[model samples]
Target: MKSKLLLSWWNDLRLKNKLMILYFVAVFIPIALTNTIFYTMTANYVRTEKIKDLKLSLEGNKDNFRKTIDSIISFSTVIYTDGSLVGALDHTYGSEAEVLTAYSEVLNPSINRFVPMNKQFYNAYLYTDNTTLIHSGMLNFIDRETEQQDWYRATVAPSRSRKWMIYTHSQPDPSYISVIRELDFYKLYSTYRKILKIDILPEYLQNTLFDQTFPGKLYLLNPQGDIVYSSEENLPQRLSDTVQQDMTVIFSVFDGVDYLQGWQIAGVYPNSVIERSLLDSRKFIVYLTLANFIFPSLLILGFTRSLSKRLGLLFKGIRWVQNQRFDLLKTERANDEIGQLTEEFNKMTTRIDGLIHDVYIAELNRRQAQFNALQSQINPHYLYNTLDAVRMSCVTKGEEETAHMIKLLGRGFRRSLSWEQDMIPLQEELEFVMDYLEIQQFRYGQRLLHNLEVDERVLDIPIPKMSILPLVENACIHGIEHLECQGTITVLAVQSGTEAHIQVQDNGIGIEPNRLVQLLGSLESSRSMESYADGKHVGLKNVHARLKWHFADDFKLSITSDHSMGTTVEIKIPVSLQSSDDDIEGGIHAC
Candidate 1:
């Protein structure tokens, strides 16, 4: 039972639901796969790129720091070489106290204050080849070791090349290097003691290094493999072996400078620096993934919703029409392709309705035309000859009233043949019919009675003019003419909605049931060869044709007869008051 229900549920999935499922598989899945593969590749590439950029940035920063330090060292030499300052320091006096006092004043501010302002300058010692180590800042006095340092030896370089050179002193330190200067500013304890040492602040030096933006670990090393300046003071003293092998990384040893004194500004960065660069790539990946999720879903939903609404409207409209409720008219939509289809559908329906209406009108007109021709065949030639003979007889017998009645019979004949058109107002048509009945009454005055009953409101209702006259003619002629007793003809014009009903009933010799059936059969099929020339049913046929023409299937003509009672012929005509406007526009009679 559970399995059957589940199967039924699956079968019940709507079209849109099935489409959404397919979309997830066919479109979204592939897009996701493509993006995932691309994202994965990009993530790896970002890490590699980061490491490359970091190494390059580190190298550049290191070189820039070297150039700055070189410039500052060179400027110091230029200052010392100023003959005035040199001459004052070398101003010979046996005491040397004046020169010492002058030097003290120049060095009064602690090395902590200015020279190596970061407090990173571990030591500053003034040295000479003869005096060895003399005055020291950050230390009271220095020993022969200061003279033995690379800074001491490089200044008095054996080749005696340039006035100054920068050196890295990583001596007894996780520290930085200092510059050695051959000063002409020394007093004469002995003329040979000439070198001055300044421990240049590595941090200050690094700060002044580069104009361009960069990131790296910057360091200055002293000659004795001691680090004097290092951006990473807390990095582990022992590095992993694999990391140590990397040319960009330094573990324990102070890597030798490629130029200058064995100590130099060096930048070290490992592959780990790539982490930051990968972050930018990761952000982009996130954006693409979000687009992947949102973009296609929105596209699919919008497409389905738009198309579905258009299709639904069309279906709903057709349903409403089928229900005979001509409503739910939708205004045209512009953006979607479905709107065009709906527009086309509307056009097709309009054309079909017009064709159907035309065909209906045509068929009705044909039938009415046939009926009219039949009714017109009711030629009272015998009555005309009889009236002529009566008039002659009356003239001979000196009866003026009988002759006058014969003239009236001739007048009625002309009127019946010439009613203006098929469709006419109710009042005019009734008057025309009454005139013909009056003429018949005059022929047999006391033997017949004719009366017309009409609703006043229906007087102006337009109807086919001769549509009722044929049945009335049958009643007056065939109905009462043969009756021995007094005969009665009643004409009723009643209004129902937009319909006009005219009923003529007679109390006379009624028709036999077989004769009534013969009359009511399809008139075209009953027009037999035997009575082909007689044409007595002309007016009846004309009325039937006119009724069919005007009202199509919505109209009726019926003949009823009872052997004991009487005969009744009813004609119904549907009319519209709005046809006045239709006639004005179409310039044709309203039927």
Candidate 2:
């Protein structure tokens, strides 16, 4: 029951709302959770890799420090085992001059040669207890003052032959790493106590052992955990004092060398530095999540909105159908089932409307037929009788030309009033035009002149009734009527291959270029007769429209004119021949 109710509530919601809810539950929530999990994993992986790299860096620094110390110890060993240096320091000098000779020849040369060879060794000195030897540059007498110093006392301690320590020689001088060894290598000639002291260059030690490229503080700690060398400037000397609670510390201990057994290389990395490294990854993840959410949400919203709009239009169309409105509903073109339904709906409405229109048109045409039949009987007979009586009266009064004009007028009326056919032979059409032109000549006298050129082969070709008459009428009224001089109207008809060409030319004041353009444009328009009821080129448009309806694309009508030259209206139509027997049969059938 609960599931059914939930489904019912869900189904009651609009399409857009339903899609939004689904997106929130399915796409939005899942993507957010997945991104959070991925970000957490990425952060953890970066931190683990960073710690591993830091450990490797610390080990490398430790190895480098040990190597530097071993080089110093090797230099000291070389001096300790030297037999000449031992003999020099142990010799009992008879006089001060002899001591100076031994010092210049032996001790000074040895010290100068060895010290300059190693960049790490700062200076080397030998201390002896012989009071007869003078205290000079490489040779020093072990006096009461030296015995009291910390490095000297440490070196002279029992059972200890070598030691490395940070020491200062005097007050106000910076400290150096000093290595001291007791010179007891020759046991048989050991007459006096001798010591060797080698001080290492502080600058060389700092540069050789520490790496500045590491992202955190680095320290070289002594046996007592004191910072003997550091990468940072002005840092405290003890490791405990320099480290903070927010720092992560990693260290590597020195092994295999007895002197540097307890020393370590420690790297102190702040937590903020690790977080800074992860900043770019965090930003990328956030941007990816936003893109995933925003793009799909917009797509779903657009899709649902379009679907709902189309459905709404379909519903509206149904309502129109319910109210008996059969007009076609305009809709967007689509290829979906909904679009197909809309198309079928429009088709149904059109068919229904056409059926109702047909019924109404059939009734209207029946009524019009009755009115035309009655009109044909009364109007034509009355007109013919009046015209015949006028002709006879003119003949009796010796007005022969007037009688002939009246007879032509009567023939024109009879032809126009006969509504039996919409098409007539080319010859009959030209005859009617000739009679009309004769009447116009009488009206205009010497001002109007006309000529006709016909190809006898096409005289029997059928054309729309009254087609050529309108062109002639326009030439007389619009063309010749405004001219000061005589106007000549030429009618030409010819058969050219499978087509017939007819032209009506007038030598009169031609139309302006702009007006001619409008006239040509009006002829091409397919507007209803009512729309062009008050238009100037109605008759020309009517003839063109009738020709187009009869021949479709097989007919052409064109007008060309130039200012003060002349205007030519030409018609080209395909020839469709019919035999004389068919015409006779059609006539008899019609009668």
Q: What is every candidate's alpha-carbon RMSD to the true fold? A: 18.8, 17.7
lDDT of 1 by residue, 319-415 (tens): 8668755543476667556777777767767776777789999999979986986676466555666778888899899998778777667656555
Best by TM-score: 2
Evaluated against the true structure, the overall lDDT of model 1 is 0.63
Global fold similarity of model 2 (TM-score):
0.46
Q: Show where candidate 1 strays beyond 4 Å.
A: 1-398, 416-420, 523-536, 575-591
Cα lDDT tens digits, model 2, 226-295, are 6666787764667888888999898888767678777778899999877877898899999999999999
Looking at model 1, residue 340 earns an lDDT score of 76
RMSD value for candidate 2 = 17.7
Give the total clashing residue pairs for model 1: 42
List the candidates' TM-scores in order.
Answer: 0.40, 0.46
